[model samples]
Target: MKRALPILAVLVVLLAAIAVANPFFLEPAGFLAFLKRAAPLVILAAGQYFVIVSGEFDLSVGSLVTAEVVIAARLIDGDESATWPVIALLIVIGLLVGLVNGVVTTKLRVPSFIVTLGMLLILSGAVFLWTGGAPRGALSEGFRVFGRGGLGPVPWSVLILLAVGAAAIWLMRADFGKTLMATGDNERAAALSGVRVDRAKIFAFMLSGLAAAVAAILLGGFAGVSAQVGQGLEFSAITAVVLGGVVLGGGRGSVLAAMAGAFTLEALFTLLNLYGISGALEFTVQGVIIIAAVAAGAIRLPWKFTPRKGDAHAAS
Candidate 1:
């Protein structure tokens, strides 16, 4: 319950704002549209939650999403026949990128923050070099289905988000998730317990990459393709995750809440747009939220680790 309070509060606030901005927001379609728009970010947040709760970051995801969309367009080129294979290739690429990020951070002993940042730059530069300026080709209809298509009244993206959310929750309740939490709580102790610390972190990063790829597919369909479609998305996902109450250094959050955080973010943006708020200020809000969330997490450490006298610290 404690894990879900922040998300619940955010959700209630956002819903109230929506109701105030436009009475129609209470209608089914309004809510469905909101869910559809939020689907990608929610999925991405779940994926990012794995990495974050495991004690790392995956900055490459934003550019990876851009790259996935671009590569999809170039390879598909309106050829419906190419969609599945190209998607498979994109998944492989995402896995490879995640694998590389994981390896460098775990085996090479580099900070994941630095390694993923380097990856973000590398991916952005590569996309720029390959596309020149405008992206080539277009996404075929079949390929676009995941993003914009739905079954009668329900969007496929929403369904997919539900599936991923279920899976993420299941993973968090499994042995791997338990091991990951232990690792995050204390890597040395986890390693000593035969937790395969390196492997857990790698898997977390891989999940983030996989999330980025999935987000890219939906975004490509809804927002359309561009050289900059996913710019700043990493920060957005991270912010949503943090707002869900997941601590930055890991071992302290819930996937369900993280998904809720994504929804809250989308609703907030929609409310802002309804109120004629400039989109430009969105990033400023995210920056402040990220810092504040992290700092708030830090403030709890003393209480969480309160020790008996002469155990660890001398009370003032």
Candidate 2:
């Protein structure tokens, strides 16, 4: 809770600023709509939180999201009856990709950075080959409801976001979450203490994949079909996580902070758009945030004493 305060505070300030800039934002309808818009990225951040806290990275999620949307469109082809089935297939594809990433990284001893980057390229190439630079077909209205429609006054995406957020909080409080943190902090120590480091890391990757699948569903419905639907989301999620004060190399951070970071980011973008900022600069902004956050984390106070040789040895 203590670690999460800064990000949460930032979210509040952003929301307040939005309200000031756009008075409509203070209305219930406006706020709910904002949540709906931010849902996918927040969920992605949650998933990324798991992997980062477990001492790994998932660069493939953005590409995986693109693949899922493309596959859903081709398979469903606007057939209402196919909505559920295709959604299920998308989930399976996400898990399978995550599983393969996990297996290759852990079992084959490949660095996660390389493995996921490769997966990202592989998925991106597959999407291009399948679509030939242009996506075909359309999403069913039934499917679109999840992204654009709502239950009465509330959007379904908002509901889904709440559910995902709750689940992430719960998961991080469970035994698995503790073990995951331990593994990230020190893999060898975790293993010596009987933790299944490989399995934990693999599961974390799978969770990230699942998050990407869900994000694709919302995006497919909300934004319609596009070859670039999921472009640059990987960096966005990472930036969000870093903004939440999660160290890049992992081992520390709260899930709530991570989610708050996502919301803060979305709010920032919204504010920027309202102020007439170019959308093209989103990537530049994210890059700056990531670098700033990581650098802030690396800073040490001048008053902190340097460790003596024996002190370092004892600490280790």
Q: Which candidate ranks first by lDDT, i.e. highest? A: 2
Tens-digit lDDT track for model 1 on 91-185? Answer: 88888899999999999999999999999999988987998866899999999999899988999898888888889989988998899888876
Candidate 2 per-residue lDDT over residues 139-243, each given as its tens digit? 899999999999999999999999999999999899989999888878898999999999999999999999999999999999988888899999889889888
Q: What is the TM-score of each candidate against the true structure?
A: 0.92, 0.93
Score candidate 1 by TM-score against the native: 0.92
- The Cα error of candidate 1 at residue 314, in Å, is 8.7
Give the true-structure RMSD of model 2. 2.7
List the pairs of residues colliding in candidate 1. none
lDDT of 1 at 220: 90
Off by over 4 Å in 2: 281-286, 297-316
